[model samples]
Target: MEIRLAQRVQALTPSSTLAITAKAKELKSKGYDVIGLGAGEPDFNTPQHIIDAASASMNEGQTKYTPSAGLPALIKEIITKFKSDQGIDYSPNEVVVQNGAKHALYTLFQVILDEGDEVIIPTPYWVSYPEQVKLADGVPVFVEGSEENEFKITPKQLLDATTNRTKAVIINSPSNPTGMLYSEEELLELGKICLEKNILIVSDEIYEKLVYGEHKHVSIAQLSPELKEQTIIINGVSKSHSMTGWRIGYAAGNQSVIEAMTNLSSHSTSNPTTTAQFGAIAAYAGSQQPVDEMREAFEERLNIIYNQLIDIPGFTCVKPQGAFYLYPNVKEAAKLTGYKDVDSFVEALLEEAMVAVVPGSGFGTPENIRLSYATSLDLLEKAIKRMHDFVESKMKA
Candidate 1:
């Protein structure tokens, strides 16, 4: 028997981050004492109150299926969250909960994208964005952001990428891979371009709560009501509350888009887990003390790692304003080691230093790599030391 996969499925590649994570795990199992900086998740466990809320819900027999959109009370909480935190007013009916941020993203593409439709995604993006667009029969237009600009795309890039078949633009602030946060002024400029082009905005704010250093996250919807109508705001408690395993995420947008996502969700995952939804409700409603403490830990780690990484002989890193990852350019190290690219550089680092990092080539930026600080301070410090030693050794070689 022969095996052939669907074209869409064939187009999808396994997540590069996860593939590196698995390799790290395998090395760990072999007693390599690997330090995994490839993880994109928080190191902290879910808060006690959220766990208790899930238990309480379970005891209350809240195990039944919820409405395809989500439980009414949870949807109401999302509305309140958007209004209070993001300063955007969304009705409960205009929100749809899904398995996770990734689910929310894929579903949005399913509903909006058509064959050959183009989506403009700034480079150094999350690994899944381009693949998801391809799965939906859309072309992902890559707009480059360099180290000079802190890896952020300018409004001019958006204007240049716009075409008749360009259906949407993905804006991820406090971005994945780079940890670059967009300022309100920057977003306002880009939002104007999107509005002028009549293109939709898919704003992924999954890392909204994980920012630092006086960096404020501004929702495109908060920029203007018109932009809000054209925006699909994706967020969740996974990163905010360290509840990634619970898998609850949502999007707020036009009623038509919400309805479409809800309908697709009904036949798909049906709804996110009931207990997880209950837990997310508590995460949104509970005391934020835990959130503050976790953010502080991440901030401290970010500072320590940033300082150490940039001091390495052939490494240069941009100071991240948000999120827990640091993207460092190691082209000089690549040159010294004769590695030829970031992938070879990363593989050599893992083999010699037992430090796991994701190469930037996966995110469409070469000669750079991402290191997650979502680990212990001791581990982060040791990993930096090891990486520095490896780079210095390459220079000598």
Candidate 2:
């Protein structure tokens, strides 16, 4: 069978995290006590008020499809959230709500990128960005960032990656897999370059609220009025409100870009779930005490796991300022483990220590592994202990 799948599908790679998680689940079902460190979301419930709002909407017969751009009320809520949290301002008409942050990003590519268009992405980016660019018939130009630089790309590097065909650049602060957050000044410098180059910026700020220490998430659009006009700010309540299942992501950008995405939405998903939109409205407009409480807990666990990783031999990790993941370079450990690479190290950990982790190759970096400390403190401590023991054994060998 020739199996006529779309050519775009051929360019896409499967999610490494979900693959690991499925394997972990299989092993656990077979009576193995697998400690999963691969999941990217927090192990918390959606806030009560948000849940209530969804129920209320459903009871009120708000089950019909919303406008493709999203409910005007929800868009208004998103505007308020951006202004209050990231100091970015946008009119409701500039906002387009979709299924999730991922959806917004993919749609942004479809709307802006033409065949052979180039998108400058920092290396070790989210696993999906490169694939998304390819799916949209765009080329992804990677600018490598080292662990020494806190996994952030420099302005010079950004400039070098640009070409006349460059369509956009993605800025993910509190980045996933690495958890590196960019400072406000750093973003301003990059924003200035984008202005000079007349390049579009796709700012993924889903993890904005999860940052720690002095690292603040400043939307590059907020750097100035000109930058704002050229930036598409992608965000959702999934990370902030622990509302992953709600699927209420949105983008704020130039009216034309937003309108194009809205038209795309009209043909594809039509709209996000109506009840979820109502709940997201409450998530934004209601009290934010729940989000703050969860952030505090994550901060506490982050400190514990980070301090432990610093003491482990043959392993090095940058203290992630935001997000729940820690990307530790395990090349030293890989050499000791009789494993050829990061994939083998991850496999050995899961098989020997019952610990599940994502291989960094999925995010364009081998010789590293990603561990999510989004679980409870007890599990995080135990997972770290097990990982430490595994590394010690490797070193002894």
lDDT of 2 by residue, 1-397 (tens): 6678898997689989889999999999999999999998879999999999999999999999889999999998888887887687888889999999999999999999999999998978898999999999999999988898999999999999999999899999889888888887898899889989999999999998898877777778887889899899999999999998888899999999999999998999999999999999999899999998999899999987788876766788888989989888988878876778879889989999999999999888897889998898898888888988998887777
lDDT of 1 by residue, 1-397 (tens): 9898798898787887988999999999999989999988999999999999999999999999999888888888889888889888888878999999899999999999999999999998899999999999999999998789999989888898899999999999889988888888998999998888899999999999888988888888898889999899999989999988889999899999999999999998888899999999999889988998999999998877788889987788889988899988889878877787779989988988999999888888877899999999999999999988888887787
Candidate 2 residue pairs in backbone clash: none
Candidate 2, residue 146: Cα displacement in angstroms equals 1.0
- Candidate 1 residue runs with Cα over 4 Å from true position: none
Q: Which segments of model 2 are wrong by more than 4 Å?
A: none
Question: What local lDDT score does residue 308 receive in model 2, on the 0 to 100 scale?
Answer: 86
